[model samples]
Target: MPTSILRIDASSRSCGSFSRDIGDVVERSLLAKHPGADITRRDLAQQQIEHIRNETIIGYYTPGEAMTDELKAVTLTSDEIIAEAKSADILLITTPMYNFSIPSALKAWIDQLVRIGRTFDYDGHSFTGLLPGKQAYVVIAYGAGGYSDDGPLAGADFAKPYLSFLLGFLGIQDVTFVPVEATTADPATVACEVEKARQNVRSSLDAG
Candidate 1:
């Protein structure tokens, strides 16, 4: 069977976006491996998903058979997002760090996907993820350096850890994170960082 890839980009900038550029490299590498892969692209910047609402929360807890039309309508986006994730064999997320975290649009997308009894299940004691056997690749762009373990600003980076935990919570344990740091530095530094990120993407794909 052909591979299925869900590519979600969270950068607001259309042009000169390092995250998107790195995503392009990742996509190309995947295509090189799986020439007939089915790729689904979700550009959050252009088509932002609405944040979860009160009605949506209520819809999640309501039994399917007992859900009213209004409740069903409020949770339609969540349904679609979960469906997409369920069908994908690989989840590719390319996002730029915003204020030391992920962008609002990306967070909204995540909120829609992390639905109970849809992507995961809980019995008050333990939780189980419904979607397993999927791999994820996350590419993050940072404006300033020092987000890595040895970096000075490591503690300030919430994007990497949050995403790592989120993907694992969704049963995507086989995940690779590629960081593009120091994007707002000098042109030479920016170029070096971008190249390093590209190399990381290629190496990761090659290893897989």
Candidate 2:
């Protein structure tokens, strides 16, 4: 079946971002795999949403409550972001590691979409995810060094694990990570790793 794919980019360094370059390849791979798939690209670097405020939060939670014109205008964008995520069959994220974490823009987007009773709900005992049957693919690029989820540095980091946890909480346990590491290792080595990542993406698509 044809799918609706949402491609999100969270790299700040426009043309020079390795993650963006890799993300393009991933998008191309997706298109080749599913010729009928529709793609929606959201570049966090370019079109970033401001951090939600207290008023925006109030507006988001107030179902039928009247809001000031300004509040309504701010909340509308958040509503659209939520709608896009909910409607997508899959989400592909391309992000560069900033100080060993996710970019602020990406975090801001999450804040908007992760509304109570929207993306998730608290049952009697625990919170249950409302979004299901969706898959996600994450591509992470590092400028220096590398860290694994089980590595010592991973515990101190909020980028990778936080993203995984939030998405998993949203019923997307089938998330996959394709990390392009060792950027500071050597220029040649970084190029090789990037190629390897692209090849892996191609192979995955081909298998599908």
Top-scoring candidate (lDDT) = 1
Q: Candidate 1 — what's its lDDT?
A: 0.93
Which digits, one per residue and each the tens of the lDDT, describe model 1 over residues 2-24?
99999999999989998999989
TM-score of each: 0.98, 0.90
Candidate 1 TM-score versus the reference: 0.98
Clashes of 2: 0
Give stretches of model 1 more than 4 Å off: none
Give candidate 2 regions above 4 Å deviation: 65-70, 149-157
Predicted candidate 2 versus true structure: per-residue lDDT over 1-208, tens digit per residue? 5799998899887877788888888888878877899888888878987899988888876775676787879888788898899999989999988877898999898898888878898877998887899989898987654466465565656677878999999988888777777666777898898887788787766567
Give the TM-score (vs. native) of candidate 2: 0.90
lDDT for each candidate structure: 0.93, 0.83
lDDT, residue 24, candidate 1: 90
